[model samples]
Target: MDTKLIIIETTTDDKEMANKLSHLLIKEKLAGCVQVNQINSYYEYDDKINNTVEYLIRIKTLSNYYEDVKEFLSKEHNFELPEFISYECKEVSKDYLDWIVKNLNK
Candidate 1:
């Protein structure tokens, strides 16, 4: 079977948490690359609209590692309900895909 590439996304209200998670993922080889971006999130909760600044975390890894990555994030995340969304990459450059595979743990 061909190796499947995936990108998992999540958001945290704390910047420190975002940085820490990103570093941990990389160090543990759960992810080839992690990106943290500042973003504004608007949602409805408790019958009220709320807006907050959040850090978006994007994790790139192989499909085989998704479970491990999700477990780690679930254990370490601070949010009551952290966002854990994964998108399968249908198209990726050959060089970039090779780099990801090379950097990730076997």
Candidate 2:
């Protein structure tokens, strides 16, 4: 039995955002893992160089607990509208997904 996983990509590239997100997710037992990556993308917002650093957070958890997870993020996130997107994992090996389930409760 595994949880439906998702990614929460934030606009900020700051390590602080990554760390806080990971800590909060795990602390609440809503996710097993939140892998963060530094990504660079170019954008045009307000005619400004919106080239920014962003974090790609891969979250793992039980499929049934998604609502609680969403609630927590909605209340805790600092941004007015944080990037919280959940994608269905089309394919996953049992071993890897099981590992994610195990590490989340640690």
Candidate 3:
């Protein structure tokens, strides 16, 4: 069977925003765990190259809860087009995957 765990990645402009989103995800049981990191990002927007210091949020949760997570981010994120991406974890440890499933509401 395929692993049910997924890693959701997104960037936030500030630490406060990242923490707020993390708390929402955990409190709502949409994510089992969230890791926040400080990152320097470079990207192109409106034909201009931009560089920024941002927070990278890695959210771990069951794949089934992704839609709810996406909805919450869409409404709460500060960016016009937030970077929300999910990758199925093909080789997560059995115990970790179990933890994610157990923490999810559903």
C-alpha-based local distance difference test score of model 1: 0.93
Which tens-of-lDDT digit does each residue in 1-103 have in candidate 2?
Answer: 4455554444445678778977988887778777777888687868887777677666767666677777877787666777777766767778877776776
Better of 2 and 3 by TM-score: 3
Candidates, ranked, TM-score: 1, 3, 2
lDDT of 3 by residue, 1-106 (tens): 2248889999998899999999999998889999999999999989999999999999998777788899999999989899999998888888878777777744
Q: Which runs of model 2 end up more than 4 angstroms from their true locations?
A: 1-11, 47-49, 103-106
Candidate with best lDDT:
1
Model 2: worst 10 consecutive residues (lDDT sum): 3-12
Scored by Cα lDDT, where does model 2 land?
Answer: 0.70
Candidate models: Cα lDDT each = 0.93, 0.70, 0.88
Cα error of candidate 2 at position 97, Å: 2.4
> Which residue pairs in candidate 2 have backbone atoms (N, alpha carbon, C) closer than 3 angstroms, thus clashing?
3-61, 3-62, 3-63, 4-63, 32-104
lDDT of 3: 0.88
lDDT of 1 at 81: 84
On the 0 to 100 scale, the lDDT of residue 57 in model 1 is 100
lDDT of 2 at 62: 67
